[model samples]
Target: MCVLGYCAGRYRCPNCGRSYKNKVNLGRHMRWECNKSPAYFCHACDYKTCRKDHLKVHLISNRHLKNVAGKIRYPCLHCGKSYTMKNNLRRHQRVECGKEKSLVCYVCDRRYYYKQELDTHVKLKHNISAKIEGFPVPMHWKF
Candidate 1:
């Protein structure tokens, strides 16, 4: 096995069967010589990407954001809540309205409607450590 480091070492290209002294040189050779097809060519915007999944995700998220920004429709069934995007409405139903009952703590097996509620429950009830998106869980005491 080749040692993983930032040093020039003898390596072989898998695609072109070419020997290179460094990984960076091998990668450059592959990019310029071996892999010529652009996998992630965006049809609408004419954007080129090497990764197909990234381009797909970009297209999907761009369309979703555009649709969300355009119109406000679709009301929640339970609480009469309205949202501009169907995805947002689905997220709201799952998180805020307690429709799907999806949020559950892995450590304590506590069920919560929203992630915020779950964090509070974990902190207050079980005293177990939990974090959400790098934010520290807030302590809420019932008075």
Candidate 2:
């Protein structure tokens, strides 16, 4: 048979005398007529993969996959707190590092390491109305 305007070349069935131009069609006939398994196998990791693209994806993903088989250990530098991932440690450092003491507030002239603390300072000290997520906070209230 012709596929995409190209002849697939003549292929003969080993079990029968039928001749087909397409190798895939011949293989389909063999699967229905004689029942044969595909012989392709992955060389690396000895994993049974159906296609070459699947094997490539497996090899690429295996490099970045975390090794969870062993015990996980991560130590925080600022306050001796430990975590599982370096990202969590970085996030903790951003909030509680205390090395950089000055923090500018967008809503007011006050500065704080924590935004909520700055919001409290703006409300109590400056007597300004501050709204957080649609909730209004009075200047005299401490929250």
Candidate 3:
């Protein structure tokens, strides 16, 4: 009932109801460390950490960015490759998935899985701008 005052066994913090083995640590935890107000806030989301470096790492990491973006981005139909950016997706297709390069462009020697990609290539390479229908990446994409 009275942990703020010294008990029979160990040092206890009444405010948080935590027991410390030593009295010095109890004083320190109550003053600075134990569940203090967040000093660092994440810009991308509502995640907050006690340290500034943690926030920096969370912002720069790929998994955190994807989670913040709600994982809504391009996914390769063939190799099931996922990308948060369109350019990254394009790069993955051109360089990574060599086997899925089946969709060929008659005008130039290029291959892609989706017609939209081929259309984009045609517009950029052959100067033929065609408004092709967008292909939605599957929401149930596996990791």
Candidate 4:
């Protein structure tokens, strides 16, 4: 059989047959990720990942310890709500746990708990810039 110039899927895992672009990636996959039991797991839930950063992100994004009593590592000073992650606790204090919904969407008149949420809403739903213009609007604002 005549081989092609550059055979794609040439590098495949021996265990799972998952293809990679290069041998280095394939070797790394086999050594660390491929067919391996997830080394990182959430303490609050069954969520698991192969990487530490992924586990950190999962812990930060989800309210895993909200209802789990005694596991709260970070507690809110104002409302006494608990969180598994410190960053989550900080976010709860800043935007949630009785904070007012100050940032409003000018287009749809929708309310948001945080500035980031409002910014995302405006950018995605309205497809408009979330930046607040200065009192004297700049020339670049013409767009």
TM, every model: 0.26, 0.25, 0.29, 0.35
lDDT scores of the candidates, listed in order: 0.63, 0.55, 0.69, 0.66
Count backbone overlaps in model 2: 0
**C-alpha positional error of residue 115 in candidate 4 after TM-score superposition, expressed in Å:** 2.0
lDDT of each residue in 10-111, candidate 4, tens digit only: 677767867778778778788888877898988877888788877765654435544345454675656656667788988787767786676566666787
Query: What lDDT tens digits, residue by residue, belong to model 1 across residues 1-143?
Result: 54542233577777656778778877876776566666666665666766666665655553533555564466665776666678998888765685556666666666666667876787788786565467443343111
Clashing pairs in 3: none
The model with the greatest TM-score is: 4
Off by over 4 Å in 2: 1-75, 81-90, 104-111, 131-143
Better of 1 and 3 by lDDT: 3
Number of clashing pairs, model 4? 0
Question: Per-residue lDDT of 1-143 in model 3, one digit per residue for the tens?
Answer: 45555677778787877888789978876886567888888776788876676776666566666777777556665666567788998888776685555567667667676667777787889886655457332333221
Candidate 1: residue 17 lDDT (0-100): 64
Q: Order candidates by lDDT, high to low.
A: 3, 4, 1, 2
Candidate 3 residue-wise lDDT at 10: 74
Candidate 4 collision pairs = none
The digit string of per-residue lDDT tens for model 2 on 1-143 reads 64442344677776765667777877766665444443344544455444455554544342312232243535454466656677876876876665654555445645566667776777787676467577554353323
Number of the predicted model whose lDDT against the real structure is largest: 3
Report how far off residue 1 is in candidate 2 (Å): 73
